[model samples]
Target chain A: MIEHYLSLSVLLFCLGVLGVISRRNVFVVFMSIELMLNAANLGFVAVARLHQSMDGHVLALMVMAVAAAEAALALAVVILLHKHKGNLDTNIFSLLKG
Target chain B: MFDVMVILPLAATGAGAILIMLVAAFETFRREGISILGMGLFAFAFFIQLTVDNSGDIYPFAEVFNGMLVANTFTKVAGLIILACGFFSALAAQTYFTQNKGFVLEFYCMLLFAAFGMLLLTMVAELITLFIALEIMSLAVYTLVGYDRHSVVRAEAVLKYLMLGAFAGAFYVMGAVLVYAGTGSTSFAAIGAVVADSGYLSNPALVGGSFLILFAFLFKAAAFPFHAWVIDVYDGAPLPVTAFMATAVKTSIFAVLANFLLINPEVHQGWVTFLFYLSILTMFAGNLIAIGQQNLKRMLAASGIVHTGYLLIALVALGSERFSGGAILFYLAAYGVATLGLFVALSYLSGQDERRVSFDDFRGLAKVRPYSAACIAIFLLSMAGIPPTAGFMGKFYIIAGAFQAGHAVLAVLGIVSSILSLWYYLRLIIVMYFREPEQRFEVAELTLAPLGTIVLAVCVFAISFYPVVL
Candidate 1:
């Protein structure tokens, strides 16, 4: 059962990474990052079960809080970019190429 | 008394931030007071940290926090650097907004929050704790980067930074999960024991997990390959913020890196070779990038990459057997003072919307305001590692430590890179003195910035002789 869950978690993480790199829309990219984090949370829970401890559950909760914080900040940046250029395209925002 | 004293600085800043937020609700509180208040609170906390920090005391409260936070001498020292950076940055921001328009009280609040996060980062002893602290710091910084909502350039910088930062952050969480799976524990002490006993290379899960975490740190520290983002973000942010990020943020990150490396010799040994080549490449690439830049802020940003390279060398040469955090801390202190001073200087002189840009803009600056030019020259010289300045002493300690650890080739390469850096560093000085005045150099009230610059110039020398403070 633990191995089954862990395999699914790995698949979800790979998909998240793929979505972030292949997508151009800022919203999609951010959502992809959240997906990646959730996948890690799933892995944590699986491992916690294998180890027969509550550590994984605690870690998942902690990661959820952090993911929410990241989402709030990402939304603020999205709004700021929209206000500046009326678009949410990542490629369009390259004014400083450092 | 000891517990109360140790936690006082953190409590004060937290309370001050809340008070400022409440004040921002009023119609006429004015942002200037918030800046002053922030600076005062930081300075007060810094002094309190100085007096209260007693190494290895392990306040009961800190332990009760479940080993997540460890307020030792090292953490206290990093906190002092962060708070002082905050205090001086507020000084620069105060002078800056007199010309520019974004004077919201929330800006100062964010700065305080970032400092709070940095303090936590330096003290974090658990992986989950470190990740949370890191997010707090990065989130506040992203907001500060785009505070100028009107500038498309600023908005773009924030977007790229946020996207990449979030991406790296996910990598960090994944890394932590893998490590937890491998070791059945998340604390540094447990991980260290496992790595030490089992050998770092043999633990596939921990090994792979560490690489991911290290990649994220390198990206944050602006090391080679992951370094391309730094220039644009620094360019888009206001001058004062650029300075704050360069000094305070880097210092905090390096502090955390040094701690992680100190965990076990075998663990670090596994990564040393990659770190060695990476440091050399980082230095040369940074110099190449910096040489091609004409804009002063972009040039400074590129130089920051080179400085990170030198710090990486310090990491490479770090003795795995010992837990000496001295070299890292001293170098960070020196870098913070000089870099913060330069940005503070730019904040005052860049004048209303930052009309200055190219190297030629500063030509013949000595003729107009010799003191400002001299202060800037001192900062540049310090950065180039000239004698009797903080930058020089910083380079000396790192190089000396590297040589002692039998990494002679890296030390020599480090010196060579330091020499290469002089080209860009001295270019500003030559422009300031050699060329005839091309543009009329303007000055403002000369209040906080000039004061900050002069003080940092003296600090360049004082930090070289840090034993005095010790």
Candidate 2:
């Protein structure tokens, strides 16, 4: 059971990384990052269960709070980018090179 | 009482941040008043931190809050550096906003918030505390970077930094979870105990977890392979914001890295070989990027990468034998002074929305404004690691530490990289003195950044002779 959960966690993390790398849309990239955090949350909970302690559960809660904060800022940035360039694609905002 | 004494500075900074935010809501604070208040708050914190004598009784609150925050001489000095950087950056921001519009009272609030986070970052001794503090600092910095919402450059910079920074943050959480899975505790002391008893390499989860955590740190520190984001992000932020990010952010990060690595000799030894190559590549790659840059801000940002490389050398030299925290802190102070000096000078000289930012823009500045030009030259030379300057002593201590650790090759490459860096540093000086003036060098006569520049230039010298008992 532990191995299965850990495998699922790793798979989700890799998918998040893939989404971040492949997607050019700003919102999608942020969602991917959120996915990555959730994957870590999964790992934290599973590890907590495996160890029979509540520390991982507490850590997962903290990570979720931080993720929410990051999501708020990311969405604000996405809105700002849209207002500036009239698009949500990351490639459209490339004024700074090198 | 000891706990309160240890946390007094942190409390003061937090209060100052909240006070400034509340004050920003009023109609009277205005731009100049808020900047001055910010400077005052930082100065207040610096003094508070300085007066709390922690040198003699090492670790006053060693087990406070479940061993999450430790206060030794190392964290004290790191906190001092961060506060001083904040004060000086606030000084520069005053002059920066004098000519450039888009000033808001909340800008100072964010500055204090970031400093508060960095203060926490330096003192964090637990994985969970480290994550929260890192987020606090990152979130504040992201807001500062994108503060100028209309600029496309700022937007791009914030997006890139936000994405990469969040990625790194997530990596840290994952690594923390893995290590928790392996060790059953999140505290540094507990983890060290575990690593010492079982050995660092015995557990697959711990090894993989530490690797990921180190990767996250290196990304934050702007080390090699994770360094490409630094130039653009630094260039994209406002001048004072960049200075704050350059000095305070890096100092806090290095402090945490040192603390993390100092947990156990076995753990550090396990990673020394990998860090050895990473330091070398960071230096050379930084030099290559810095050499090719035409924009002055981009070049400074790239040189910051080179400085990180040198700091990495000090980290490599730091074994479990003797604490090399003093060397790292001294180097950070020296680098902070010179880098902040250069940026403060640029803040006033860049003139009217920073139109003149490239290397060619400052041709023959020496002819028109001798004093300002000389100050910039001193900063550049100091950054180039010339004699009788703080940068020279910083490099000396780091290289000596490397040699003492028996990493002779890293020491030699460090010297080589310093020599390579001299070209760009001197190139700026040569352009200022040797070329013909392209435009009229304008200055805001009643500004504080120039005053800040002069003070930092003096610091570049005064900090050199600061005795480091390594």
Candidate 3:
């Protein structure tokens, strides 16, 4: 059961990584990052069960809180980006090429 | 009592941030007053940090917080550097806003919040605490970068930084979970104990987990493979904000990196080979990029990357040394003084809305404003590692430390990279002194940034004399 859970977590994490790298839309990229973080949350839960401790659960919750704050900021940035460039594509926001 | 003293600087910065927030809500407190308040708060924190006296073995508030945070001499000095960076950047911002039009009262509020997060970062000894501190600093800085939302460049810079920053944060959480799986604990002490009990390289989970963590740190610190975001982000941010990011943010990140690396000699030894190659690549890569840059801010940002490489060399040496992070901290102080001095000068000289941002824009500045040009020349020379300046001394110590650790190749490469860096740093100096004065350099009379620049220029030389522990 632990192996199954860990495998699923890894699968989700890989998918998220692919999405962040392959996708062009800014929204998709952010969603991909969220997917990656939640995948980590799943790993923490599974690991907590393996360790027979609640530390992983607590950390997962803290990560969720931080992820939420990050989502709020990401949305604000999206709106700001749209106001300037009128597009959601990350490639379009290329005034600073570094 | 020691706990209170240990927590005083963090408390002061946090309280100051809140105080600024509350005061900003009222219409009576003006903009200049708020900048002064922020400076005062940073000064207050600096003094408290100075007097705390962490030279002894007293962990101060170690047990009170369950060792989640520790304040040693290393942390105290890093704290002082962060606070001083805050103070001077606030001074720069005061003058920056006076000439430029975007005057939001809450800018100081955010600056203090960033400082608050950095102060916490310096003391955190636990993984969760480090994550929280990292986010607090990143979030505040993201906001500060895009504060002037009307510009397309600023918007673009913030987006790039935010996306990459959040991605890095997720990587950190994933690594933390893996490490927890390996050791069943998230504390540094617990991990170090585990590494000691069953060596760092022996455990697969610990090995993978630490690599991921180092990747996140290197990304944040703008090291070799992860440094592409720095030039654009630093170029897009406002002058004073860039100054703050260049100095305070780097200091806090290096402090945390040193803290984590110092966990165990075994841990350091495990990654020395990878770190060695990365440091050398980072130095040459940075110099190559900086040499091609035409913009002054971008050049400084690229040089900032080279400085990160030098700091990496210090980290590779950190394993063999027992001076306990003293060398890294000394190099950080020296680098900070010169970088901050250059930015403070840029804040005032960059003119209204920062129109003069390129090397060509600063042609023959010495002919019109001799003092400002000389200050800039001193900063540029210091950055290029010329003698009798702090940059030279900082590079000297890092090379010496690396050589003492038997990493002679790394030390020689560092010197070569600094020599490459000289081409760009000197290019700006020559551009200022040699060319004919075309554009009239008009600076505001009541600005505080010039005063701040002069102080930092003095600090560039003054900091070199302060002897390092080893």
TM-score of each: 0.96, 0.98, 0.98
User: Fnat of each prediction?
Assistant: 0.83, 0.87, 0.80
Of the candidates numbered 2 and 3, which has the greater DockQ value?
2
Runs of candidate 1 with Cα error greater than 4 angstroms are: B1-4, B57-63, B320-323, B468-470
Give the per-residue lDDT of model 1 (tens digit) for B1-470.
Answer: 66666667777777777777788888877766777787888898788778875688363345465556666787788889999999999999989888887667888888888888888788777787888889889998998988777888888888878888988988888888888888888877778888888986677788878888888898999999899989998998887788889988998898888777776787678778989998999999899999999999999999999999999988987764342667778888988888888888888878788888668888998888899899999999999999988889888888887887888999999999999999999999999999888766666764677888899889888888885211
All models, DockQ values? 0.80, 0.87, 0.82
**Every model's Cα RMSD, please?**
1.9, 1.3, 1.4
- What does candidate 1 score on TM? 0.96
Clashes of 1: 0
Q: For candidate 3, what's the TM-score of chain A, rounded to 2 decimals? A: 0.97
Q: Which candidate is the best by lDDT?
A: 2
Query: How much is the lDDT of residue B290 in candidate 1?
Result: 98
Off by over 4 Å in 2: B56-64, B320-323
User: Model 2 chain B — which ten-residue stretch has the worst lDDT?
Assistant: B56-65
Sliding window of 10 residues with minimal summed lDDT for model 1 chain B? B57-66
| Model 3 lDDT per residue over A28-47, tens place | 99999999999999999999
Query: Residue-wise lDDT of candidate 1 within A1-98, one digit each (tens)?
Result: 97788788878989999999999999999999999999999999989988887767888998899899889988988888888788988888767765
Which should have the higher DockQ, number 1 or number 2? 2
> Candidate 3's residue-wise lDDT over B208-276, tens digit each?
788788889999999999999999999989888999999899999999988878878876777789889
| Residue range with the least summed lDDT across 10 consecutive positions in model 3 chain B | B56-65
